[model samples]
Target chain A: MPSDSHEIVTQVYAAKKDNKAADSFIEAYMPFIRSETAKFTGRQPSQSDDELSIAMFAFYEAIRSYSRFKGAFLKYASVNIKRRLIDNSRRERRKLGVVSLDQPAGDNEGSSVLSEIIEDKGRPYDELEEREAVHQELAELTERLSVLGITLSDAAENSPHQKRTLEACRKAVDFARSEPGIIEDFLRTRRIPLSAIAQATGESRKTLERHRRYLAVVLLIFSGGFETIQEHIIQTLKGGAER
Target chain B: MRYIVAECHPAYAILLDENAELVYAANLHYSVGQTVESPVLMETEKTSGNRSAIMHTVRRAAATAAACLLIFGAYRLYMGSADRSAGSTIFMSANASVCMEINNKGEVISVKALNENGEALLSGYSYKGKDKATVSDELVELSISYGYISSGDTVSFYIDAPESGVYDSYRTELLGRLGSYPINTDIQKYDSSVQVRSDFTVSTQATSAQPETAANSTQSYSSMTETAETPAADTEAVTNSTVSTPADEQQAESAYPYHDPETYTGQSGEGNENWHGSGDHGYWYEESTDEEENESSTSEDTDQPYNRRHDWSDGYGRYGQDDDDEDICQYSEDDCDTSSESSWNSWFTGWSGYRFYSYCEREEVSECGGTDICTYDTGRDSYFSCEHGTECVQPDDTTDETEETEKTENMDETE
Candidate 1:
């Protein structure tokens, strides 16, 4: 009996000359292509998906270029396929932005653009009912923030104005996200856990204390039950205000 | 870790600009159930002001988008349509040298010789759709033509290598020719081994022959052919024989060293049933059967264990007797020294190989007239009566010995 390498060599040589053989080689590895694409995309890729097509083309390209010196065929093919899918996704992201701020807030009849929702300053009176609802939500948020001795005025005063300071404050919020114990402790004790935040973030304790109120508001939104304001705060922190 | 907890008012904005001014507008401290008007300026502020601000922002954004679209549309109109030649496809042979550009209706647009010498050879020939000719040089031959496949407007270039040029040159030339067109091109290169004068006449014939000839020339073709011809039958037979041979051979070898000559001959005869390398074991079985028949005819030979064992040995010899004896002996010294020796071997053997050993042993004992004795050999207890077919104890003799002991005890007590 011929070894596995021998069999593959024959199939590859046949594939180079015959269209049917080349197609059969592709058809045989279709499941493998789908699995690799799914691994990269984090979801099962379907036949109609552009990612699947890119993976299949990468597999074909691998077959054309493969030699015995390249080692195992599937290993080489898998690496090539994954790299191609990643490159394709990056290119697609550049050409067609994956996350669009233009999407409507919801299926509700009066739902406005996400950009408007994130920038809450100029809400139209037609959305006054929604604004009234947000007013009550803000009252609740104020009650929550007061647990950390942070008032609305404190947050306004503590809000970072310079881009560098905003970035540093954003990093602190990100640190708080990864370490939820700090948020829980702050809520339970009614004070910012500055040392814990510093330890987790490797930031100076003073820096965390200075941005305590701003971080408190960010953390409260992240703590859940405040979707609209959370989206706005997150976008603003990501420099969406300048955009 | 802080022990001190303080109560503080959370009724205020944290991130908004001038949030302290906005907090007085919150009006959360209003007296419950009060009929008085609240002093919240932001809430009571007219909605017209907010609406105007929103309208101004929306209008500005719309104007910006319109301006971007206008610029993009203008750029597309000015510079985009220059490179697009509608429905024109290019076809080149295996080498990039010989090229033919065809229009939408399968009409030849231009034929170019990319190589140095072939420029003059293919130039002035107006092969425009009527370009059906075999241009041959000292090295190779070119058959170029315009034709139709199911996918419309195919330019088939059959490269015929008559004397001496590499297939790569022709193929590279064909690829280069197709690469120049800004349209979807299908360039099919016929096998270089076959020499055809024109693509129009022999396109179908050469295309069909390519796969077969390519299959024949492959280095692994013989192995592939073997795999293809009797795929099902050969796979099954090969796999079964390959799997079973090593196991059976090991058993035969393991039995060979320790068994008595007569028992070894019997065991090997049955163990090697699947082993066809030797002379027919069928003939061996027949000769042994004749001897057994003659021996059994002599009814006076009841003492011979082989005579009593032959009936049960037929089944046991094939599967178990030879193999299980070693296991039973191994278990006897270590485990059978305990009180439950016999049952432990039975349990161990039952769980291991010989799932049917228990049933076979019971049947064999019964078929030996139910008087077949269980002899305790110090080497290995008689797990099977005819494993050696030599030593066995009758069940009636053991019963007699127990009765004698009972009688002796009664006599002593009476005295």
Candidate 2:
């Protein structure tokens, strides 16, 4: 209603500030995440409802961590969508015979692996929530990594989605940094369909459905990687996209 | 998706899905064997851009890159056939030449007197005589024209300028007076001292300005028969290539000056030290008494010239002072002891509104000195000069008595 959508976003941002209430806000917005990720769904062979769940949690993360000053929550949410999609694609490629994670992949396999994406659902909801929690813990554990001559950026980059996916996921976590409840309100007003939101936000639907593995992590120091609210927090996104 | 020659320009082309639904094609480039891999559709919508294929021989992949580079003001010139014909004179003079000339990181080779009358003329770098090279860095080579270079009916090689400068001499042979054929290139690795020089005067039109008095056509430039008096400017004069400045053009220009001179005093012997203003613009010095002295004494093929053309160059010695005197630029009371362009006749007097040094330049200068010393030149002029460096003022051309009497009027001779 204001000159920019950023104006409406500011409200949701205000609500997300209370980390205690971030879960409802995230749940209400999971549909948006589902729809956004759905666009990239067919592109990955391993893409499934489960991946949607992880992306949903990621969306919750975007909601919880989003800041109004960063513009519309959607803009910040876009990066989260891409991260979940790519992470899921990369994981699926490795799980299937399509791509070998340990091998030095030549350029030839890049296209072939790209073609093999999106044949199955993403990781299950329970498994993703556990993984998300461990990641959160791992992020906290990594603070001492610098003592081992490991840089946060370097280690993060070498991890799952490399530094890029970590950054994407991290962005979603910071979504609630500003006004908190704006995402929930936005989803309610728009009546964001979970699947539609999932596809758009790139959060996993499974992660969206089982939304509290991370919601209880409020007492956990918002330390680096505690998927504290991962279930209640984030999800892998699904969508059909061009490589 | 395949491309045709007509709309192959890539801006406008209609694309359709197998279902005949219109697919918006933002941009695309396809050659004879080009392959366009389809996107993988959703399990529910499994048909858009879905394919498992390999492709080959793409000149470039950015269906949008060409347009993007175009936005960046860069373009590609796909070389064509017909370069073998010696007399073929293709290309217009309004634009930078692409086919004939070449440049390295530091130096630009002016192709002023190329004779296309011979078989090697058209084959400057394209395969006929040389092999195409692949470089890991950005490369640029432009030819101005193809003809002969000579001032009159005779192509002349003029000698001027200092040593550490870019070229030793600027010349163009004129058996035929080539219009303007300059080879301009951006050197990814610009090392001033190590740039390659072509001093040989074979039937080759391109030659360095390293003075060659009695060298034969076959004489190697490295084995100098005789070094010219001044460090000759070895600029290859291409047909009609002027490399002129834009008075104040906002358009994009080369960072290198080729033959542009910048004096230490910072005025333009030809122009100002555009090192900051524009890359092509070099530091310059104006004419005044001290400039007269240096021009008279130095035969070292003119070290970086304090410009003769710019009056202010000589007046301030381009540093806004004089060449003969030794004074640095002026700053605030706390910064320096003096002010700049305070002279009655200086351009800064009327236009500058009030005397305030360009803060950027003022910040870098050392503290000012006491007893501002005004010195004389070969021509004997005087003005307020600093202790370590001389001020940029002209020598009093008048006789000694007149100079003394004039000093008496201002009560300041700076003796």
Docking class of 1: incorrect
lDDT of each: 0.41, 0.30
The DockQ scores of all candidates, in the order shown, are: 0.02, 0.01
Off by over 4 Å in 1: A1-126, A238-243, B1-415
Compute the interface RMSD for each candidate structure.
36.5, 27.2
Q: How accurate locally is residue B279 in candidate 2, as Cα lDDT from 0 to 100?
A: 18
Give the 10-residue window scoring lowest on summed lDDT in candidate 2 chain B: B342-351
- Tens-digit lDDT string for candidate 1 (A1-243): 123554565465456444457668878878888898899989998666767766776776566555433577888889978877776767666767465778888988789879877866754664555445545566678788776666665564455443444555667777776788866776677676778767766665655565667777767767777664554345555543341
Query: In candidate 2, residue B221 scores what lDDT?
Result: 32
Global CA lDDT computed for model 2: 0.30
Which tens-of-lDDT digit does each residue in B151-244 have in candidate 1?
2333344432221242345446555644433333343333423222222111221112112221122222122211112123432233234222
Q: What does candidate 2's lDDT look like per residue over B56-165, in tens digits?
A: 01211232244234323321221111121121111111111111222222122222212222122323432223211211010111221333221232212222112223
